[model samples]
Target: MSSKTLISVVGPTAIGKTRLAIILAKHFKTEIVSADSRQFFKEMHIGTAVPSAEELKAVPHHFIQHKSIFEPYSVGDFEKEAIAQIEKLFQNNDYVVMVGGSGLYVDAVVNGLDEFPQIDSKLRDSLNQKLEKEGLECLQEELLVLDPKYYHLVDIHNPHRVIRALEVCLTAKKPYSSFLNQKRKKRNFNSFYVGIQADREVIYERINQRVDIMIEAGLLDEAKKLYPHKNLNALQTVGYKELLEYFDKNFTLDFAISEIKKNTRRFAKRQLTWLRKNKNILWVDFNTEPKVILEKITNQLKTNPHA
Candidate 1:
């Protein structure tokens, strides 16, 4: 068994992963490494729903607001950087906490990223141009036709994912699903997954309320500030994209707010779907108190120290 263990806190958005991660880190006297993709971009703080100033002070965190929207980052880059960071942290502490709702990012750290054959740079550029010309719907449709299984599992609304799948199909002469199903590389440290779950209605309610709070905290202004860069991949997230439509006069404020809530609820559903497929996860219901949750982890850790 490895001496160092990684504790991952995963769940749908608004299920309190951040709060639970902080509590776990404090108990274990360790730091946190955020796996949230959106939170990596410094310009997207408000729309990304990053942890508050108090939360940051509670425990040191890595990978939060460390990148620019213009920078190109891949899961392979994240795997290298996050594993290096975790190794550095493990030199000081045996256990470290990682928290996020992004399945791809979390999977990258735990399972290692998949290796894809390199395509010509010109081919990639051509695909990107076609995406901009014909819109994401065209790319999404092609991805669905090439890799239905990945289409079902991936974030369909995510243009990057669609483009990536199309890239695999065009370059490899095989469906992207074929490569995705290949064996995942192993990791050095033991990973203990702690998942938080709630009833659908309850989870949806929390997502809706969180969106309302984000609006109250000036999400509109934040989106407006980035309106000029709405075409950037970083700004394609839920909170910003909807508000961008509002700026384009495509929708009223009320309509935009409703769409944010609706899309967030859908996102939560997708998160649950992704998490449930992982059998290694040990799930705890949200109805349990935080102290109770901590006790459960503590007891489990005592029995299985290497977990």
Candidate 2:
């Protein structure tokens, strides 16, 4: 059998990754396995920026809205499931498309996740208590001091991710990043990364526009329904958290919307930081035509055919 390739379409949020991935999937006559962590829950539609129904109909997509917000779906679970799906896909197609803005999730599927020593249950419970009492800022500060490297790389706003890293650091007595990139699991397929690029100003403008669109599409109502479950790890993301604050009377609606835009911009910056570190990705302008990018991928596959 010929080797299979996993073509990863990755970029910051609101950078047109979904459109490009769809076009590429159609071109290759294959399905897409999403790596976007936020889009995993069935309850989060508008806030997570899930692909439109029409877009989803354009290509068969797996792993989108496949789980519930109440369920515990870790990156390890995603890595296992995504590889299983890709293995099935490779039986029919030589190339399979994987697209999303979640850098860690994407890396989990491509390179395999790092292993960490088991943490003491008391430490985890203590950290959870600290989170509830002192707020996420306190945990962020602690992580900054404990593992500055991972702090810079991680989504500091996500309490689950921040606490997870801290737990690993405290238990292993080493920086959380020290465990990363230690060893990669061998897979049956090769992976190639395609990153969408844009100027900082343009990216921020697009994010603001997307936030406006989300609000106009009744994101407030969607978030309100999930307000009771705000404490869930899945709801700890940027969009829902900001709007939940509005519902809690913590901020005015306008202010909450503004915060969403600002935080999204910061999230985009962190995404770019993570993606830029990968020297192997073929970067393309956000406005570049899909066919042009497809041609680039074809050339790459020609040069490195073996998976």
Candidate 3:
């Protein structure tokens, strides 16, 4: 590993991670690499809570709104791109910032993905076929039967995730979760993790307010424009998916908004569950000042230097 550090700021949605990351980037005079999966799409802006224009102009940012909804992007793809971007950034700076609430994408950059045996294309096609015909809930049920552990952990609402796990389970003749938490790849730079946290109630309320703000900012109109391609994997996001249901006449507008809040809270809970497993994270309260957090980070790095 080199003397460079990747300062990864992680927390649940609406937890002020972006603000903290910007502060760190400004302090270190480095760029930011975003790991927020939904924020990658150019079409998703308001609902994804993308940084405001002023904030984007504050520091150089990579990977945000860099992909189209029509394009297919995966965690593996992001991992490669992000590591490369950080490498480029580290040539001039000692520290780089990576910030997002997407746990899998963040972990992909920091620890590398767990290896799994490749399943046959035919098996995957069959699984997708099952999904289209049987609906997401059917495959979700089967996954619960095949690998209850992954079923509980994965976003069961996502068809891609559901089919991926099912194919793995069938081919490996074992639970998909069994393939996870394996050995990780080494990186060239040191990683220093920081997390923002708050009481569950406070976090939930913040999410609710954020969703309302999105709605006020014309998220419903944005979702309506994308409704024609609601089945696209990129559209399977928390804010857009609920509105898609409304457009499909399966949900009322009010109920859809409520579901967005409910689903976002669930996503935040899952994020916390994933982040808590990492013991190296320097956690701070959501209300904590950025300078205070920076002091804590400096103190830790004194003992655990990036070099």
Report, for every candidate in turn, its global Cα lDDT versus the true structure. Answer: 0.88, 0.93, 0.91
Give lDDT tens digits, candidate 1, residues 1-307: 6878999999999989999999999999999999999899988877788999999999999999999988987777888999999999999998999999899899889887777889788877988898889988888888888888778877777777778888888899898877753576767688889999988999999988898899999999988988999889888878888899999999999999999888888888888878888887778997788889988887787777655
- Candidate 1's C-alpha runs over 4 A off are 303-307
Q: Give candidate 2 misplaced runs (Cα > 4 Å).
A: none
True lDDT of residue 13, candidate 2: 95
Model 3, global lDDT: 0.91
RMSD of each candidate? 1.6, 1.2, 1.3
Q: What order do candidates take by TM-score, descending?
A: 2, 3, 1
Encode model 3's per-residue lDDT on 1-307: one tens digit a residue: 4789999999999999999999999998999999999899999999999999999999999999999999989899999999989998888999999999998899899889988888899999888888788788899889999998888778887788888899889999999999887887889999999999999999999999999999999999999999999989999879999999999999999999999999999989888988888898989999987789889998898789762
- lDDT score, candidate 2, position 246: 97
Report how far off residue 139 is in candidate 2 (Å): 1.0
TM-score of model number 1: 0.95
Candidate 1 vs 3: which has more lDDT: 3
Q: Per-residue alpha-carbon lDDT of model 2 for 197-243, expressed as tens digits?
A: 99999999999999999999999999999999989999999899999
Off by over 4 Å in 3: none
